[model samples]
Target: MVTVPTRVRLGYAVGSFCTANFTTIPGLLLLIYMTNVLAVDPLLAGVVVFLPKAWDLVANTLVGQWSDRTVSRWGPRRPWLLGGAAILPIAFVVMFIGPPLTGVPAALFVGAAFLVAASGYALYEVPYKAMPAEMTHDYHERTSLLQWRMIFIAIGIGMSGILAPILAGDTVEGYRLMGLVFGVILLLAMLASFFGTANAPYTGQAEPEASLKAQLRAARTSKPFMWLLGLSSAQTLGAYVMLAGAPYFAAYTVGSTGATTTLFAALVGPMLVTMPLWVWLAKKLDKRGAMILSGVLFMTGAVAAVATPLFGPLYAHLVIVVVGVGYAGLQLLQFSMLADVIAYDGMVSGKRRGGVFTGLWTAVESAVAAFGATIYGATLAIGGFRESDPANPVTQPQSAEFAVLIGITVVPAAIILLGVLMTFKYDLTSAKMSQVSHDVT
Candidate 1:
């Protein structure tokens, strides 16, 4: 058994704090910012949200391929990691500054900022995801490693998920403060990983396939990769949609905007605390099977959460605990399973293009999440959510409340079901993983 040093694992997991912060801001808060601060139409805001991830899709693949072929002393992935870390915070602050301009001019600034921020994160995240396959061959070890990684991911989600809104308050000034403080947090986390993981052994590409076309071809031919690509993207889309619904659910359904952070704490805190239990479940059931079980659990929880309003005023938070448990399972297992698929690719293809695979994985994930914003914003627009004014607060209508409920409940439940079905095609059981790892080593 190859043991990954505890520091290396800790370093790698800390990087996820930055990734989670980047993901949380846009997923949870960005579109709302468009409606409230910029006075952009909800439909237009959705369009703005979806369009920039197009750039993110392109960047993930290009950078993934770039990392695979490059030869450097600092290592192909590390140099880009450090470079991206420095540039990302600048764009992070820009997204929240919500320039003094209004109408189309304001919309354009936020859109442009998202493009830059998403692009910067691609450089860091694709390489970061790729590193795990190279780090170890043990199947359960990958799960354990990723379990810690997901714990930090939850920590990021918890801190930023709840804190960003509190810090930003319901004002433009609060958001500006949020941008500066959280931007620093993001910069520090990424840099910590870059320096802290200095002792990690770098895996060089052994095969000669270097072109982007070649890399894409490699990913396309791998059946397991294709299966995981769809499954992971679907579940992530569901997760983001559910998160986007939280503020609305709090505002319209639960009747308190201040309940937003409490809802987030309910979701993330329980998920974080229960991660070790999910890890144990994955060890018992194997990653793919564990993910299937998590999907079912999440689907049921999401559906059940919809009815929490009938129970009482504050009952929604308690209902969210169920969703959080299932979410915890999915978060912990899916990434470990991806690591398995990457290992399988290295073995069957006789090449270790972990960077390209992870890149494409994240790229498609960005593209799918684009639709999550589209779904959230377009649905709210359909429900007649009045965009907030700079001078006055906004009240949501029945249409808005209805849209949020479905997005949180029915939509996520369905998306997760598809992800569970895709798992039937994901064939890496524990016994098989042993063979896959041996083939690579």
Candidate 2:
């Protein structure tokens, strides 16, 4: 019954620039930056990427709990959003400022900057994710708001995915400029959200839980939330594996680094155009059905891409467009479902615990995303990937090229298919939500 204002929706959606840019750029390029630019071993590069984000397991939960208890004029969430806006950009810029060293030293420097950046990212993301449930109780309105968010996410992913590579080139200096450019973008987007939601409405804010353990205990009891978490974690992992392998797929598998931008463009273009169609489909199929269809599409693309060696770059780009279509739906529905679970919790339990649920959601999402990079890195290691720098470019072994193809294709396809199967466990239909609303109201 509640309809969010268009200005508020747009304000909230703009924050996706921060979320999408931070996650996509690193997942898409950081591993390559280490292996190809810094001359770090593939396995070591993966570890460096993984360890910093692993910290999110702790930081996100704490931030969530902290924000839940926060008493601020800016509201519980916006203060942290402001903090993250200021800090993350600086840390992000530092992440790719390009250390004057290589190997372990370079890895350590980048790792430290990333750890700070991860902390800053958690500051914003946990509370930001918690907002929609608090914003409105209407299920469809949440989806509407998130539709706007996904559009921005698509734009953010598209711009960064397409341009960051071009900006970073294959050299250290290029990466430095890319970092500065995106950092400013991150700052402006996050601040816009903080100010844009200045007059946003809140449906309700319940009393905070006694402790983090108690909050999480309450969250664990929600079957819908649990199932959603499992489903999203698996989906994120599979997607990021493909993302991590993208550069290698461009260079070695497609025989040109320029393909990275084109590949990402293919993957993001559909996300921009088809979001409304997916949202409409969800009305007919229900969110769960739409989710399954989207997963199938993603799996189909990934499976088809395995034959890229036979079909070549044009085929690779075409299939990636399929993956992009599915991905748009997946990204929109996952958080929309999370908002449903959070709203349901407030109704059933009489407490505002969105932060706890979102913290867990973000922690798992961040970790698994990083883990995807590690998985691809391990695959590259298995194929005996040779690390090199711009000064001394080296030809990759055929085995490494094979690893790139399989890592980007079969591994992701299989993992995403399993996620699709897990969707059956999610039983939070609109009918169920309508019944819950009737009972609560």
Candidate 3:
């Protein structure tokens, strides 16, 4: 087995940190900022956030394909990494500064800036994701490497969420301060990864020249990959739906704005703390088994969340913690499984096409997530929610309970169930992954 250096692993972790900061900020707070601070209609604010992410569907794949073909002295991935690192902060700052003018100008500014940020994210993220398959050919080592990266990702996400509120001081300041702080953090992490991993050898094997269409066609034909894509996209949509509605749930359902922090913490904190345990479970059960187990846990917790009116917030939080544990497993295993699929594709096609696979994976994921957010935002509007009134009671129009229940439970449960059903199509196992690694090496 080829061994990689500690710095290479560290660089990988830090690189993910930079890219994830953008996701964490908007993921946790953008909705609140739009509705409460900028005073965009809540449903409209949701659309503002939702529209930009849709760009990722096209942009991420194109970026990945372009990176795969490009040759650079720094290698295929690092140049884009450096460029993205430099520009991401500026895009981030623009995204959260809110529109300078009201009406169309404001909406246009938010949408345009968000699209720019998503592009920057694609540049950095697709290359960064493609790195692991090239970095090590060892099956177990890849798992270990991904575990460390996920840990850093969890930390970056947690820190972004925890600190954004503190720095914001209020909704207006929160968006501005979060933009600045996370922007700086992203810059630093990007630089660290770029410089630190610069000398790390490009261990990736070469592929026969193929058109982008051929590469995409090859990816489409991979059954295991398609299964993973379906499962992860569905599961991710559920998670984003729940996350997108969380702030509203805390404020309205629970009758406390402060509950937003508590709810965020409750959801994210356990996953961070239990990451190691999940890693152990993955090792013991294998990625597919772990993922299946995660689906079961999440489904149970989601059902319990729907029962929150009967059980109260305390019980709901406890059940959600159980769900968080499952989420942690899913997060770690899903990417590791993706890596396995990349290796599988290489072994079958006699090509190193990690960039194409990762790019497509990311693109599909972005599209599904964007669609999920759109549905969520539209649902809130249908439920008769008005962003204008912060003090509106949960029982208003007596329809909000249904909205909260659907957002927190029914939607996610259906998505998770679909993901579980799709898993039967995944033929790749740990043994298969091991064979692919052996053949590649």
Candidate 4:
């Protein structure tokens, strides 16, 4: 029997914080880097930002499948984790350093570095995500594990969001310093997780003889998994658009770049404070109910945020606080729900195939990010956004504002609403998941 200590669990969560730091910094700052510092056209920058992540759509799934069948003395997942800890940080530093030459040469260098970082992220993230399913078979325990994990995720987001601006100083040096800081923290976190968490013994539960095609076919046929994938992909797009566009809106629309820090603090602060509330809601209403309620709040808040220009900064900030509350619930509960889905798949297939599922999950997430960047980047192009002049009178060109509004509110709200609709298809209630746990064990 494998027992997960509270300390070990906490260590895993902290490790996730480190691993996510690389991605969070990029997600929050990449657009700023391209447009403001590098003088890339906003539209073109968006494309550059969007395309590299799209590569993850393919990479994440392939890495996941490979990890699942891997056999080793240190176990399958940890080796990848250890390896990524070393490689990802170096890639992250190189990404921010930019290329030796100017213009296209620089852009190509940045893109190539980002590709390497994404691969490293997959190396850790797929196995990290899979651990929840493999660690315990209990339904409530899965929720508990995810809840813990999310707390750390919030920490990562908060640190990256709040500190990146402060550390980076100017756009150019700030990105470079932020990369170095995040890379160091990531290494520390991975080492903690490696030393702390004990792997659950493999029970010969994976089908050693199963062909890759056969496993893919099985995953393809899973209806519940498919529905979750659809919902999650849409949600990813919504979240990414907000992340990518918020800084621009803060600087140009609100007339305050500091507002970016304030907004992020409002968003993540609630998540950290009210995690217990979200966990309770999950327990009382169940994951699907909690998700739907959270989605509604997210939609309401997003719509309200879009209207900020008309309402003025104070009112807009208030609306954002409200939205943060909703975001807190949705973000926490979604991963918990994902853990449940993985367990359900395991029960039905009679095989532990977490690597494949996590891989696919991460792939969809990366793809959605890519898609959102495409939309955001193209919107900037269409709107004629110029990044160099923070105070460019042209920054708020009617077309640009329209694009920001669409990216921040209209499109995100629609996507979130779709997520709510899809929640109805998640048939794995806690009770059902509990039953599945019993049978699988």
Candidate 5:
């Protein structure tokens, strides 16, 4: 039996505080800040959102490849964690502070700040995500371990998602303070994870690392890897957009600041409550099936969201709970499945390149999120959503309301439906993964 200490797991899971805070909350708030706070053109702001992602696509892979070859007393991944702990928080803070510029200049400043923040985040996340495959070779144990991590992810999302908007309510200064407070929390969480996993045995990360090119080649050859990447990237387009656009959806469709909170809770509450059910389902149905099931649930909720104007916001939230239930399954299985893919790769490829693969994973995640924000921003720009002014709230055009509807509904539903079809062809199964785990361990 491959068992890990609960202490180590908690320590590692704590890192999700930083990851969730950085990914979820900012993803929700940033584009709005650009359009509303600085009065940037929505389409141009989307371009700013996209620039850092382009960098991460290249940067995360390089960082992951470098970390794999690192030789240090603390081991390969841990040292990067500490560096990330320092850099990401500082970068995060900079991204939110309003520099005394507007239009293209303001866009340029935010784009630069976000690029640095994304780079620091990738440094921490890629190696952290890769750690699961190295720490446990047990097929089910990895799932168990990741369930705990998902719990931390939930906590971070709930706390950050609620706090950020409340703290930054209708003002630039408020956002700055929100950034500072969350920056401190993020720093603390990263340190806990770095120190917490001090005693974890490094099983999969053997020395004599492969060249970056060879590692890339192996990841390319893994069908399971490619499938997960495509499925996740496609679905995340909807997921990130829903998260990023929820405020707009609530404000325009539901007509209350509180509605955004309700939306957040509807998603997070069910996700927290039903995670165990999803984990168990993964055990019974396998990751691929679970993901497809999740996709269906997500599509159903998104389609329901399209009719927000007809149903009261209360009913919309009820439907969101359904989406949340499915999101839990997708969230857990995708992560656990990736760990399985890496383990499988280690078995057949004769090398451990977990960092490189995970780096690529973060790269894809970053890209999709960036694309989500940009696509939504462009759509809103087309729909005539007014640039935000905290001093005097701009009345959005009728088309902008429909744009939020599309971002939260139509575009995402189509993409998720496509991703669900892709899952049908995914060949990795629990039985195959179990054999891989047994052979390796």
Candidate 6:
């Protein structure tokens, strides 16, 4: 087994801090920013949230292909990491610094900014996700490395998820301040990853595939990867749907905006403390078994949360802690599984196509994350949610409050439950992976 340095593990994991902040804050706040602050209709706000990420379906793939063929002093991925560090923060700040406009015009402005931000994020994320497979060849080591990432993910999500809402509050100026503060944090995290991974190993040194089509064809033909993608994408969609609904659930069902912080703390706190436990679970059950257990845990929590109206906010918070336990497992295992697939591909095909695979993974993930917000927005619109500005604060109807409850609970639970079928279909095991590695060596 090849061992990775603590610095390399840390450098790579820190990049997740950037990813978690960008992904969580937007899914958490952007839709409400539109519906509440900009006075945009719920459905329109959902569209605005969803549309830009749709561009990522194409852009992330192209960036992945580009990074695969890139030759740089900084290496294939770091150059793009630097590019993202420079551009994404600017676009992110622009996304939330809601201009002096309302309705469709405001939606249009955010969408445009978000489009650019999505592109910038692709520049970083696709290549960043590809690195683990290249950094080390050991299957279990991939899990160990990603364990650090989950820790950072927890911290990053915890900090951003809890604080961003407080910083933004319910006004235009509040959002701008939130944007600037997080934007700086984003820049620093990205740069830290780029500089930190300066001396990491890169063992997957095969020549790049001739074209994106060829690389994607390779990924499509990999059964483990395809199954993993389907289930993982479903898991992402469910998690983000709940994330998008958190603020609404807190404000309407719990009757306290401050509950957002408490809820996030509940969700992320387990992730910090239980990552080692998840790593151990993966070892005992293998990645697929551990993932299935985690999904069940997540689904159970979501279902139990539906009773929050009966039990109150404390009940909702406690159930989410259960969800958080499952979330920690899902987050760690999915990427570790992906790393296994990528490494298998490198050994079997002898091509440097990790970027392409990761590109596809990140693209589907980003789009699904956005769609989670869109789905929640559509749910609110269906419940006849009223949009209003701070100047005219609107109290949501009973139906709207119910919509918040269901969106945060039932919708995600159902989505995650559906993903279990795909998880069952995934067949990669440690023995099989070990054979593949032995064959290659």
Q: Write the per-residue lDDT of candidate 3 for residues 1-441, one digit (tens) a residue.
A: 667788787877877777557766676576666555554565677787877788887888778787887787888878888778867778988887764443345656777888888888888888888887777766667777788788887777667656666676445556677788778888899888889788675667676336778878878888988889999998888877777776666666666656666666666676678777767776788777778888888888887777677767787678778777777777877888888788677777777677888888887776676566666777777877655423332344667546856776788778888888787677788788777767656
2-22 per-residue lDDT for model 5 (tens digits): 688999889889998988898
Model 5 misplaced stretches (Cα beyond 4 Å): 205-208, 437-441
Candidate 4 lDDT for residue 225: 78
**Stretches of candidate 3 exceeding 4 Å from the true structure:** 100-105, 389-396, 437-441
Model 1 worst lDDT window (10 residues)? 201-210
Models, CA RMSD each: 1.6, 0.8, 2.4, 2.4, 1.4, 0.9
Each candidate's lDDT (Cα)?
A: 0.82, 0.93, 0.74, 0.74, 0.84, 0.92
Runs of candidate 1 exceeding 4 Å displacement: 203-205, 438-441
RMSD of 5: 1.4
Which residue window of length 10 is worst by lDDT in model 3? 387-396
Report lDDT (Cα) of residue 137, candidate 4: 60
Query: After TM-score superposition, what is the CA distance of residue 84 in candidate 3 from its true location, in Å?
Result: 1.2
Cα displacement (Å) at residue 421, model 1: 1.9
Give the better candidate number (4 or 5) by TM-score.
Answer: 5
lDDT over C-alpha atoms for residue 237 of model 5? 83
Residue-level lDDT of model 6, residues 262-374, one tens digit each, is 99999999999999999999999988889999999999999999999899988989999999999999999999999999888888999999999999999999999999999
The predicted structure with the larger TM-score, 1 or 3, is 1
lDDT of 4 at 368: 79
Model 1 lDDT tens row, 208-326: 36578887898898887888888888899888888777777777777787888998898887777898888888888878778888888888878877786688556787768777888
The clash numbers for all candidates, in the given order, read: 2, 0, 1, 1, 1, 0
- In candidate 1, the residue pairs with backbone N, CA or C atoms under 3 Å apart (3 or more residues apart, or in different chains) clash, namely 168-174, 383-399
Over 4 Å off, model 6: none
The digit string of per-residue lDDT tens for model 4 on 70-141 reads 888867777778877877888888888765343455566777888888888888888878777777666677
Better of 1 and 6 by TM-score: 6
Candidate 1: residue 38 lDDT (0-100)? 74
> Whole-model lDDT, candidate 2?
0.93
